[model samples]
Target: MKLLLAGIVLILIIMWKPMPSGAGDMWRAYSDMREANWKNSDKYFHARGNSDAASRGAGGRWAAEVISNAREWVQERTGHGAEDSAADQKANEHGRNGGDPNDYRLLGLPEKY
Candidate 1:
């Protein structure tokens, strides 16, 4: 009877043990902040206009790279890369054309974009 009671206690302890936290719930947030810094750095450079088209293009390219990294982070966390790509494409297109006239559609873009 004592053995049976001990076995039950062990089983309860095993069941109650905590599961390990996922990396998506932790490290990915730091990765995202790094990526944002890269993109914002590009915008800051472009605003200055100290360089010609080629250098500005390079900055834009870096921004694209940071965006890609952010997308990968999102994919790892949610398993939904296609959705992020579609949303990103829409945002880029809007920026290229100087944004939508309608305020509702314009809600998604950041104030500077």
Candidate 2:
């Protein structure tokens, strides 16, 4: 009886769906890239002694472009592209709404009654 109970408990634990961590990790990586890009752009602009409003605007745009490129590269390398991010967001939202974290509906499937 104890062995059977233990088996059931283990199964239940295995079946439990935990919150996804990929989105958080992706966000952290993106933020890091953005910061690095911004710092590099700032240094480049400052080195050229071009701290005018136009220079600042150009630097910001360059930094954003670099971050976007880096994000796409990371996603392609990791096989977790924008679609995965969207699914993760949906699952996170569904979990916050009291739905199961692993629910199929979170993947945009029609819910079966």
Candidate 3:
């Protein structure tokens, strides 16, 4: 009778022991979720970095264009710019006609004639 009772207790202990299928599934699911979240975060940060670099390049190009336009506008308003452009054109034409390669007059320098 005592042996039978001990056998029943051992059987109950074996039945109540934790199983791998129960807690293991929960742990695996949690690990998969963590891995997926990490991958999503990495992709988001990579895309953000690419977008930031592209925007910085575009902004730099836009700033350069604005500065160029401003300088051209100021040169036009000063009055000397137009005259120099016209003189440069005329000097280029004269140099072409005379077949002169070294024409200092194209530089808008004062001529001593």
Candidate 4:
């Protein structure tokens, strides 16, 4: 099946390019978001995490894609709204495509972020 093939390919990619710094990039983004806890900033953090990881190179990009997609998939199954998940996915893709994470940054978010 196509889905099975895709899953196998995905597994191979993960094995081939286990992210090093990219994982840390994603983690730092998450930690920053939690520390900031600024209002209306979820999307920004999502973008930031993806962007930071993606900037690391191909492996990082793949890791970001896997992580983001997995997160969204989990969220959608756990009572999260489809619309919000879609928006989050859009932000993830935007960052993966090299869009500035700051574009999603809040107007007055703490400079520490």
The best candidate by lDDT is 4
Q: Flag clash pairs in model 3.
A: none
Candidate 1, residue 4: Cα displacement in angstroms equals: 80
List runs of model 1 lying over 4 Å from the truth.
Answer: 1-56, 69-73, 96-113
Location of the lowest summed lDDT over 10 successive residues in candidate 2: 45-54
Winner on TM-score (1 vs 2): 1
Q: What overall lDDT goes with each candidate model?
A: 0.38, 0.37, 0.37, 0.88
- Model 3 regions more than 4 Å off: 1-56, 83-113
User: What lDDT, from 0 to 1, does candidate 1 have?
Assistant: 0.38
Please report, as a residue range, the 10-residue window in candidate 3 with the lowest summed lDDT: 43-52
Please report how far candidate 1 places residue 6 from its true position, in Å.
Answer: 76
Tens-place lDDT per residue, model 1, 25-100, is: 2233234334445432332222211111112233333343344446556765887667655654454334333343
Using TM-score, rank the candidates from best to worst.
4, 1, 2, 3
- Name the lDDT of candidate 4: 0.88
RMSD of every prediction: 18.7, 21.3, 35.0, 5.1
**lDDT at 81, model 3:** 64
Clashing pairs in 1: none
Worst 10 residues of 1 by lDDT: 45-54
